[model samples]
Target: MIISASTVKDTSENVEKFVRRNLLGGIDHLVIFLDAPLPDVEELLDGHPDVTCVRAHGAWWGSTPPGGLNERQITNAALISRLVVGFVWAEWMFMLDGDEVARIDRPVLDALAPQQRAVRLLPLEAASRLHPVADPTLFKRLLSADELQLLHALGVIAEPKQRSYFRGHMSGKPGLRPSADLALGVHHVVDTGTGDRVDTVKDPGLRVLHYESHDGEEFVRKWTALLSSGLDVAQHKKRAPVAASVAALLSLGLPEEQTASLLEELYERTALDDVESLTRLGLLVEVHPDEGPRRPRPPDDEVAQLRELLRRAADVNKRMFKPRARNQRAPALIAKLQRGLR
Candidate 1:
């Protein structure tokens, strides 16, 4: 089994932690393909002595090949990895993004067969929801390399229409391999950057943590800069808005689901009149901008206003001590004001 990772510095911590935790007794070789600069690559290798590290120009192992204005750095990396798999005599070659981790319940080598094309390991997804809890689910896996060349050939080209078919080709079969009995799951920790504190996966002893969600502004900056140099510029930029929203929501003490709802309320302008009232009463618990003023108090103006309102109600009640004729307006006004106070 070969563990391969291609990444920049932002994800280095997650990759390092994942490798340290999961690369246990049976793994024959641990290979990390660093797509960052040589200096960053050396930095990643500084502490991780158990894993073998290789520096590369780009990520090509599990992604589409570059074309047109896009450079072929990724394509070259893919080709190199394919060759390594074939030549290294690896029975099982597992490829993943640097932020992604593979969690196995049973030993991986025990599942391999002599003539199998490739095994599809699924991921368990961890995400935050509005209910103040985490949601965990199973994710799909990529092909185990039976024929590296075939997989590599398809990877260099964009095949949105052919993705499923490509998986079939990797399976070396007509369509998807029907393996209902042995469903190896992948836990995609895609929304690690989410605000809601939800546990995404069940208590399945098997799950991999994909650290894509944990990335912050620095990660975004580095990735966009690197990918923009010679890769798909738009693809790298697409994550910005979502990432920003996630960061903003986290700043708001609300859970993921509540944040989304609050955002929706903000968009609809439904929070306008009630905003002041809620804030005054301490009913609104919005995250302060810049973490400023953690200990919040009701505004003096609001407190004064409430006091004046109560005083006016008490004065009116005292003035209307006796019930007047049914036709009198003073009693009606007093009743209306009292109702309003309630």
Candidate 2:
């Protein structure tokens, strides 16, 4: 299976660790699309034979509609999907967030039949009491004993549980067939040609372990960063008022108030004691490790070619959409006028 992800500077360490763990888990290739420029991206991948890094320059948040949903996260997934469809050779591709990992019970390809256009993996949220860690291996070790939680059913609507806490808990992410003309959303996929939902298989064993938040401080920092990122003007406008209220509360040193009112309102705090619940139900179990041979590194020239493609894509994006000064003439027109005068 092929793995794809998009990331920024703050999440680089987590992304690296995620890739390493996946490689060890027998994933054949990894393609990382960086939304922001990270100078040490290649070094972080450590020249892994099966990894390719692409630096994206376009405005990733442009396509998302104004809502509470994080445009950056959604657009990042879409960008990775676009790239995978354009370049990846794998039949099965899994797109993941920097803080998410997929636990596969069987070989990823073997788990999903060839006829399936996509597969949905249920999400298992992880809880931590300490600050967010940089090492994935260490984080996994910590979470080995840490409690796991799932969103509680708020009510019953037409026989379906109305759970609105985590956005992705109900509709899981699509493990796509890259060859198909599919348009990826945050937690779903649609056919690009027909504009219809793709045929998907639900795999009970393929689960996503999400490190949603590490602690109260981390949660605040995450929200603050999201508010400041300027990815969605509407989202920013909507959050600015709540953030002002939260800031006032923080200045008064009323952290408990902030956690109860602001944090709880934004994220789900219902502790279902999922680890124990799943254990008692005989549902939560570990996946078997795949002991496959180490993958061979791509040819040096192939890596060079991929780098060249990234460079060209960046240049084209800059030329097409880099902001211009007010009433400024187009660059191409200015260049042509200057050449004529010369």
Candidate 3:
């Protein structure tokens, strides 16, 4: 059977969406470790047959305080991955994030060769806020050499340094064979007994759709905490450039509103701004996101209602095209960031 694990500190709505979507994607059970003191998800999935919510106050997180969020995730994933063998009959267990949803129609491990101990699912990052194809969300992925050339030729990314195609991670997450003495690390699976990384088979068909901060409000909300929290995320390869910029911005200690204002243009430029061009170029793929909840919910948690508001009102979508020159408003932001760097 297919199972998944995650450490989430998200609102009930997003949690509900993630659970239902993954369940529909063929995950038999989801082991969710609550990393927050209070988020409505535990009550939301109180007795879900297919979900187990391990609270922060429970014996789980109580053993020791995690050094940081990523540490917590790594710990939780390893804990459940090792522990799941006792209670559940599972073949593959995926460790992803609350902001991520696996695009697995049927996660079958039985067909995998005996040596294929783990599977890697590359992420397709959410780029647009609204698309005619909102059945799922519009996400950007790493292009092939030819596609990368097309992007450069069309000036989609403009400078090589400007965009990394996918903004979050390229290493991907793993789906491990639980019986293989496996533990989920930050990005891949490891043999707990030997402390060696497992050989991973990268599945192009199976992927993780990441809904990172798609707007300025979300962009600030997500990054401000990390940049200022001393998480040392700037050392992360994919995140270093932007993380450094945001950390620099935070050092300025400018008013919250000013920081957000400065980041507006930067967010637009780095985010997948032109969906139409990407789609035409076959750089975007569409998946249908499940709107129904795994369990019955209050009025606010309904999918039919949430989907429209989420698409048309709450979130915004943008077109894809050539990367443009930096906006006039961004220079002061840059100057201030430079000052912070000093």
| lDDT (tens digit, per residue) of candidate 2 on 1-342 | 455544444555556667765665434566666656666765776466667766543442334332332444454454445433434344456666665666655555575565676787666555334333531121221112113222233221112222322322435556777542564555666665555667677765666666555454545665565555554434354345545655554556666765556554443243112233344534433433223344554456544444444343442222221111111333343233224222
The Cα local distance difference test for each model comes to 0.34, 0.48, 0.62
Candidate 2 residue 322 Cα shift, in angstroms, is 18
lDDT of 1 by residue, 6-60 (tens): 3334455555554654454122334554555666546766455445555443342
Ranking by lDDT: 3, 2, 1
- Highest TM-score model number: 3
What's the CA error at residue 24 for candidate 1, in Å? 4.2
TM-score of each: 0.39, 0.60, 0.75
- Cα lDDT of candidate 3 equals 0.62
Q: Model 3: C-alpha RMSD to truth? A: 15.8
Give lDDT: candidate 2, residue 340.
21
lDDT (tens digit, per residue) of candidate 3 on 174-241: 88776525677668777655567788887667788887775555676678756644467866776777
Where does candidate 2 have its weakest 10-residue lDDT segment?
Answer: 318-327
